[model samples]
Target: MAKSKVYFTNLRASFGRNLLQKLEKLIKEAGIGNIDFQNKYAAIKIHFGEPGNLAFLRPNYAKVVADVVKELGGKPFLTDCNTLYVGRRKNALDHLDTAYENGFSPFSTGCHVLIGDGLKGTDETLVPIDGDYVKEAKIGAAIMDADVFISLTHFKGHEATGFGGCLKNIGMGCGSRAGKMEMHSSGKPHVNQQLCVGCGSCQKDCAHSAITITDRKASIDHSKCVGCGRCIGRCPVDAVEAASDEANDILNCKIAEYTWAVVKDRPCFHISLVVDVSPNCDCHSENDLPIVPDVGMFASFDPIALDQACADAVNAQPSVPGSILDERERCHHDHFTDTHPDTNWESCLEHGVKLGLGTREYELITIQ
Candidate 1:
């Protein structure tokens, strides 16, 4: 197989040029213009960052991608699916508000914002993947509706999957609310008796009628629960939680499969910014100190290769003082594994490669 090519450009900029100018140059080098974007609906999949997270890609970067798509006559929109966890982005309305509050408004990015899942996060299209762990993936409707897909990822650490890269961004980030539930757990949510308010919110939102309120507490009939995860967001007190961490790993594997469902037939391009290197996922509203110095920006036609390259780059750099890595006596040689010892990021990439999503091997081309 031909090795995928990953292009890179460091943060250094000439007085006449800025990072945005360099981003455009990098995209052209990656051949993103080859896609037939004329008169097509282009979806620039991105994380707008939870309101307090400072590590997310700046809106200026999104503008560069949006502008390129529009110049190709494509109707570009910045998009991301609703979250499964109980947070500000749990639904479309609140998700949009969070996006705008973070400066990702249509006015800023030269495009509109559409929560991939609809009003309730259940608005999705089931895509069959025939994978080992997942047969079908529930993807957000708006994401599946687009003619083209582009990922703008903020490369960072993840507690479960080792690292958050292009695949994590597309696979985990693109799942609809129900799909996210499928990706994060093995079973339906369980009500913390102590936290349940007996408000019947879970029962009201459950389409399966699996939840019941009695004695001022919520109980779930596991057999009747479809594991839809709707109740996770509906609980007023955040009483509902997934089965366990084992289930979260299963959820991660399923997320990889779901990501395959999204990018399988699309002309895709990926860009990962290796700056603001947080120790946790961008899903967190608050970001911490970076673990390493700003490296550079990378673009690739292969998602897996791009991710692997980014991880390798981070691993090669010396750890930052007073950061998460500094707290440990011995630095972990593997970037993702060092941060998330239990997570095996390679598994996700290997599965992605086996699924023909992209290659793990690539030729890293430095643009600077």
Candidate 2:
């Protein structure tokens, strides 16, 4: 396969030309505009950082892309799928509020914010892809409905997948809440007796009538449960939990397959911002010191190649002093692996390559 071009831009800004200017230049250089944007509904997929997390990509960068898309005649909209975990983003209303609170608004980015799944996070489109792990992927309705896909990822570490890069953003991020359940576990969610409030909220939402409350505690009947994962969101206390026995390797591979389902026939453009470099996912409400200095922004026509390039750039830099990486001293070569040892992010990349999402090889073109 030919080497994919990953365009880059540093933090430096000059008087006549600034980093933002270079960002536009970089995207154009990567041939993003070559995709016919005329009258297309372009989905600019991104994670509207959890309420208190400050490590997410700034709306300023999004504005750059949104403006470019409009200039190219595409109707762009900022979007993300609902979270499976109990948080402000579990439902569309709260998710939109959190997004607006976190500075993602039409006024700010020259586009509107869309919750990909739907009002309940259950509205999705199941796309079939013959793969090693997942046979079909449940993608968000809005995401799967887009005419063109553009992933704007905040490259960082993840607890489960070693690192949350372009693939993570596209795969795990694109999945509906139920899709997340499929990727993360095989068993249905069980009510945690200690956290259960017995308010009957879970029972009210359980389509299978598997939940019951007695002695002011909720209980789930596994025999009747359908694993739809609706009760997990209905519980106000986050009393329901998915099984943790699923193998991590399997989960990563499934993530790649799901990502494949999302971008299979779409003209997709990918961009990853290696700033903030947090030790954990943006799903966390809080962000720690960066593991590395603000690297730069990268763009490519290939998601896999863009992710590999971002990981390589991060690994090449020395760990920042006083950062979380400073507290540990092992496996210094792989930054994501150094943070998360058990997860092989490469598994997702290789799987994505085999699925033909993109290549693993790339040429970094700096826009200095």
Candidate 3:
């Protein structure tokens, strides 16, 4: 297939053209206006950042996207699925609180912030892809309900995926609890005995009789558990947890399939800012120093290509001194791989191409 166009702009800006202005110019030049967003609900998939994580993109960036959507006569809202982990973003209430705390209020970003899944992480839409690994994808209901989808990602390093780019932002970030469980784990979730208070919420919510309360402690029967991940969302105390045991390559493949399920049959666009460049996901409560210096912004209609371009951009830069990549052995000579040697970021893009998502081959069109 032919190469996709990935538009880019450097961080250098004059008083006449700020970074936000550059972002607006970049996406418009990259063909965001091609999508007919007239009076439609455009869901801007983004990570509001787990509370205390300063590596996430600031609300200013989100406003630029939201403003562009509104200028095109679309109703836009910033959104993210509640994280599966026991953090400030595990539930809708707490998620909103964290979002507002992190400067994502409507007053600031000029758009509402919606937790994609409902109060718990169980509100999902079952999208059937039937890929090699995932039979169906459970995506956040709010995300799938939108008329148009756009990913505004903070391109950064991840412990699992090597780097979390457009594909990871839309795929794993949009998955409901069960969808995330399928991507991250091969086995079912188990109860944390210490955290479990015998509330029976999980037992009551489980469609299968997999959980039992005994001696004020809860345990999961692996044989009986279907891995629906409902219990993980329903647990009042956040005791039920999914294991992160999936291989990196397999995890990347699953993430690609999940991404296919989300953007398929919709008008989707992507934009990733290659700043911060943290060594871990924004889901982590704390972030290490950036492994690479700030690159700039990249946007594309093809998410797979967008991701590939972002990875290439990161690898092209020299590793930052006094950062994690500097401290690691550079056997791979690739920034992402050197930072997280075990991760294979290419698998996601390759599998995405196999699924006819988009080609990894891209021509970077510098917008400056």
Candidate 4:
């Protein structure tokens, strides 16, 4: 395959020009206008920073992307799926509240905020992609419903995937509760006996008769359970929990496959801002100091290439003075591996290339 084009622009500003303006110029120059957006429902996938996490991308940047979509005659909405782990964004109600509290309202972003998964994170659309790790991917309903998909990601370090870039943002970020459970764990969920109030809600929701309640507690029969994660959403007390025992390498591969499920047969665009280069995921309630200095913004039609470009750029930068990367013993030459010894982000990119998502080789064009 030919090298894909990834456009880039540094975070330099002058009078009457700012980072938002630069983002607009970068995407347009990267060929965002090539897509037919007229009358289309565009989903701009993004992470509304976890409550108290100050490292997430600002709402003002999202507004620029949404405004551009409107300019091209598309209806845009900011979206993200609920997290598998318990947090401020575990359910739609709490998710929306967090979005608003973090300044991602319809008024602020010039578009409505839609929690990809519905009320309890159970509303999903199963996408069949015969991947080595995943046979069928369960994605949030609202995300799959969009006519056009765009990933606006905050490029940063991740403990599991090494760095959360385009593929990470779209693949892992778009999965519904069950989808995430499938990606993170190789086993089925177990009921928390203490949280189960003898509520047969989980038992009633299981389609495969995999859940059984006895003595006011629920237990899952692994033989019958398909790991669809329905019981996790049905439990009133949030008792059903997925076991995250998958190794980091397998998890990265699964993330790539999930990404393929989302962008298949759709017009998808990707943009990543390598700013606030935090040492961990934005899912954390708090952020550590950036491992590297802010790089800039990148945009591409090919997400795999976009991620490769971003990762390469980040690795080239010097480590921040007092950040985690600075304190670590830099034996591995690679920043991400040195920061997160157990993770191999290249697994996701390699798997993505093999899956025909996009090429890892990219032509980085600087947008002045």
lDDT of each: 0.86, 0.88, 0.93, 0.94
Badly placed stretches (over 4 Å) of model 4 are none
Candidate 2 deviant stretches above 4 angstroms: none
Question: Best lDDT goes to which candidate?
Answer: 4
For candidate 4, the TM-score is 0.98
lDDT tens digits by residue: candidate 3, 211-324: 889998889999999898889888888899998789999999999999999999989999999999999999999988999999999999999989988988899999899999
Clashing pairs in 1: 183-251, 184-251
Q: Between 2 and 4, whose lDDT is larger?
A: 4
RMSD of each: 1.6, 1.7, 1.0, 1.1
State the lDDT at 228 in candidate 2.
Answer: 73
**Looking at model 4, which ten-residue stretch has the lowest summed lDDT?**
228-237
Q: Relative to the unseen true structure, what is the Cα RMSD of model 1?
A: 1.6
Please provide, for model 2 over 1-368, each residue's C-alpha lDDT reduced to its tens digit, 9 standing for 90 to 100. 99988899888888998877888888988888899999999999999999889999989889999999999999999999888887889989999999899889999999999899988788899898868877778899999999999999999988789889998999999998888988898777888888888999989998888998899999999899977777876778889887755677788888889988988887989998889999999999999998988899899988999999999989888888998787776664787777777778888888889888889899888877
Rank by TM-score, highest first: 3, 4, 1, 2
Candidate 1 residue runs with Cα over 4 Å from true position: 247-252
- What lDDT tens digits, residue by residue, belong to model 1 across residues 1-368? 68999999999998999999999999988888889999999889999899888889889999999999999889999999888777889888999999998899989899999988887787789999899888888888999999999999999988888888898899878888777777776666789999888999889988888998889999999999987778876776889887744544565667678889999887888999999999899899899889889899999988889998999899888878988776765555686677667777888887788888888889999886
lDDT of 2 at 88: 80
Which is superior by lDDT, 2 or 3? Answer: 3
Q: Candidates' TM-scores?
A: 0.95, 0.95, 0.98, 0.98
